[model samples]
Target chain A: MKKDELKKKRIIWVIWLVILIISAYFVPFVLLRGINQVEASFLYWTVFAVAAILSTIKITTYWSD
Target chain B: MNSFYVYLALSIYVLIGFYIAYKSRQGMKQGVIEYFLDNRSTGGIVSALSYSATTYSAFMMIGLAGFTYSGGVGALGFELIYLAGLSLVAFFGPRFWLVGKKYGYVTPYEMLGDRFQNKWIAIISAGTACVFLIPYLSVQLMGIGYLMNGLSGGEIPYIVGVIIASILAISWAVIAGMRSVTWTDSLQSLIMIVVSVIILFYVIYTQLGGFVSFFGRLETEYSNFLSVPGPGFFNFQTFLGLTLPWFFFSISNPQVSQRLFIPKSLKAMKTMIKGFLIFGLVYTLVSVLWGFSAKLLFPGLQQADLATPTLLGSEHVPLLLGLIAMIGITAAAISTVDSIMLTLSSLIVRDLMQSRDEYSDKKQLRIGKFVIFIIAVIGIIFASQQLDLIATLSVTSSVGLMIVVPTIFGAFFWRGATAAGSLTSIILGAFTALYLQFGNLSPLGLAPGVWTLIITVVSFISVSLFTEAPKKKANEFLGYLDKELEDKNIL
Candidate 1:
């Protein structure tokens, strides 16, 4: 991969990560607050799952570089 | 519940560990660097496993579980944030590897010393690490002792457990240094992952019925446990306080950072990074689940730290599985403690004792072994004191070590970073962290960790601006590193 392309990919990944982090904090503290505990728990898990998936995807790019 | 079963299992495990240590001694030549760093020739899998074992300690099984049990899903978030912090590895790992291989630097402090052209930087960094890490090491030993005593139904005393752990931790490192420790850490990491996975599945299916039911129960019955400040223990500021330092743990902790030096090639280093991420994700999930499981089955426990022991001792858990869990936790603690002991010994022998060029590698090797023994003895003594919660003690050490992060980043990334700035930042930041921690002061509700980091960064940058920069040396080191990295197509 070209250095420019790699840098672009990294920048995109960082933006995705930041968005996920915001959503992770938002869901539990704001959006899901006062929601049913079970539903909120599931929402939190979904957020974590998404973050985990994102992390795995990021790590998979290691070999390409 | 018999102490005999616990002893029997542990004896077999220890014997196997000793065998691995003996095997690791086979191809090793006598020299300080080779013994301390496996001649910087560690392969991908062993490096990955050793890194995993070193990073995830008894704290995962015992301390983290308890943290989740009492603190709720916030614990999960805190830990995941730590996982996210590995992104820093993606940036720093290759840089460290190239520099280490190029300079033949064994200890992280050695890198700092050379980078800043100040021996005092190396001395202070090592000394700071020693001061904080000793308590951290003792906490791991204490975890083993407590787990053993708990698993044996009080038949085996905690002191005996401490002795057993102390012996294993010391013997493995002293036997063949990094070679033995790396091999054993690989084995132990496997055991930790496998045993934790098995137990997690068993509890989720047999005890909680399945994931759906488990989640259902937690949602309905323990809603408060699903969010921050659920029980008011993990308020936002407090959570940040607990996690901010750990967010920088990849660079701040020297044991893990030093492993960046050991992989044989860039490809091998990539393998190590990928392998550790996978291992870490699985282990972190299992550990968090252990805490959640404990909270579900045994509510109303007086102390959060009792979560693991209570859950394992419950009628639903099999006796054999409990014994395996005990061994897994012991392996986790010993894996971590042995690495810390080795790193500390290297810091003392290679960085400190050999500073004046008065010793041979042979003499250094002997001194390194002696230092390992001495550290183990000190750890045993400290563990016997049975200090505060394992999580608290571990985090305190981490927070103290956070003072180094700014200086380290400056050394690597910024050309203008000066020796005076680095030294002042570290000394002041370290003292401030310790003072705020021991004095129990947190200004503006921020953790001492966050404050110390702020102060350290400001001090480093400001002092560097006003002070002399090692322009020629910085350019030489960074310039060569850049050219080499580009040549190798690693950047």
Candidate 2:
């Protein structure tokens, strides 16, 4: 892989992880409060977990070394 | 509800466990590398299963379900946050593997000691790990002890369960070290996961009337449980405090961190990462649902921890399935305890005793084996006391270990991280964790975990800037990683 490519890829993955984690902490408590259904927060977290797992799989899929 | 069934199930499990151990050691060699690391040639699937088994414990069924029972949906988020933290492994896995292979490091502490140009780094890191991890070990034993006693309707003594776990953990580990542990871990991981999945589906479908019905019941009666701060258990600061320490668990916990060095190939490492994530996801959902089922079925329980045992003993979960689940939970605790013993043993030999000029590799292995026995004994004694402090220590262990995160990240990313700074952060961070946790002081409504991270980060950076770093070693270490990050085309 090119040095620039590796650098960019690393930055992208790091940003994705930060955003994902921060959202997991804040979104359910802050944004989902007014949503009356309990499944709203529950479903939101389930979606978040699946997204994180998929993101990780994507990040690692191309790994070679 | 008879203890005889528990003993019968365990007897079969133990026999199968020993057979696997014996087979794993068939051609196993003598010496530290072979014993501690399985010669660093473990495959992807076995690595994934063992990693899963070692990471998720009895806490999943009993404690996590209890958390969900009390705190609601936030419990799922708390664990999912830890699951997401495995991203650290993706970033740092290759670096650890390359460095470990190059330096012939047996423990992550050994890697830390060498990277910082300070042997004391290894000693203190290892010492800190042993201190925090023992409580965690004892808690694992106590889980099995209590589970057996409870499952038998009080036929088995609590101490009997504790001793059984310790004896089995030591026996399997000593049989062939990593080989025995990983192989049996793979088997137990399968039993834990498959049985849990089978029974979870059965309970949810039959008892709770399936997914839609289960969610409908919770949504109608216990709606708050589906969200945060439900019944006021997981407020934002509380969640942050608990999750922060665990988010870095992949690196902070030495037993898990040492796993970065064991894959036979880079590809195998990738497989391990992906495999563990999938397993974690399925297992997390299953455990969370289990908790929710208990919340709906038996909402009048006096204590939240009674969720799992109550569910198991109720008319809901079948007798045979419950017995297997008991063994499954037991397997979960033993697998975790098993890995910790081996990792602590390796750290003791590599970080503490390696400096002795007369200590040969064989002798080092000998002492390492002896240390496992000693650790098991101490664990039994501490857990046998059932002190509030032991449970407290286990829960807050990640907080203390989180102090090592700054050193770990700096060692790889920055060249300015110094031994003095590393030592300062570890020592002070640990003290800060101890004071706040024991005193039950949460300054400004922030958790001890949050404060520990804040202090450790501040100390590590400030101390490094003020002190002299081992610049030469840092450059070589970072430079090598820079040049050799596993080029895909070549591989």
- Listed in order, the DockQ scores are 0.31, 0.55
Residue pairs clashing in model 2 are A65-B486
Report residue B73 deviation for candidate 2 (angstroms): 0.2
Candidate 2 residue spans exceeding 4 A from truth: A34-38, B354-357, B486-491
The digit string of per-residue lDDT tens for model 2 on B82-197 reads 99999888888878998889888888889988899999988998988998999999999999999999989899999999999999999988989998999999999999889989
Off by over 4 Å in 1: A1-27, A34-65, B354-356, B387-394, B489-491
- Which window of ten consecutive residues has the lowest lDDT sum in model 2 chain B? B482-491
Q: Mind giving the per-residue lDDT tens digits that candidate 1 earns over B1-491?
A: 99999999999899999999999999789987789889888998999899999999988888889988988777777777777777777767877887887888899889998999998999998998988999899988888888888888889999999999999999998999999999999999999999999999999999998999998898888778876667677777787787778878888999899998888876777778778877887887788889989989999898988898898888878999988888999999999999999999999986776453687888888888999999988888888877664334455788888888988888777999999999999999988888888778999888898888899999999999999989988998889866654455443
Best by lDDT: 2
lDDT of each: 0.83, 0.89
> Where is model 1 chain B poorest over a 10-residue stretch in terms of lDDT?
B482-491
Give lDDT: candidate 1, residue B326: 88
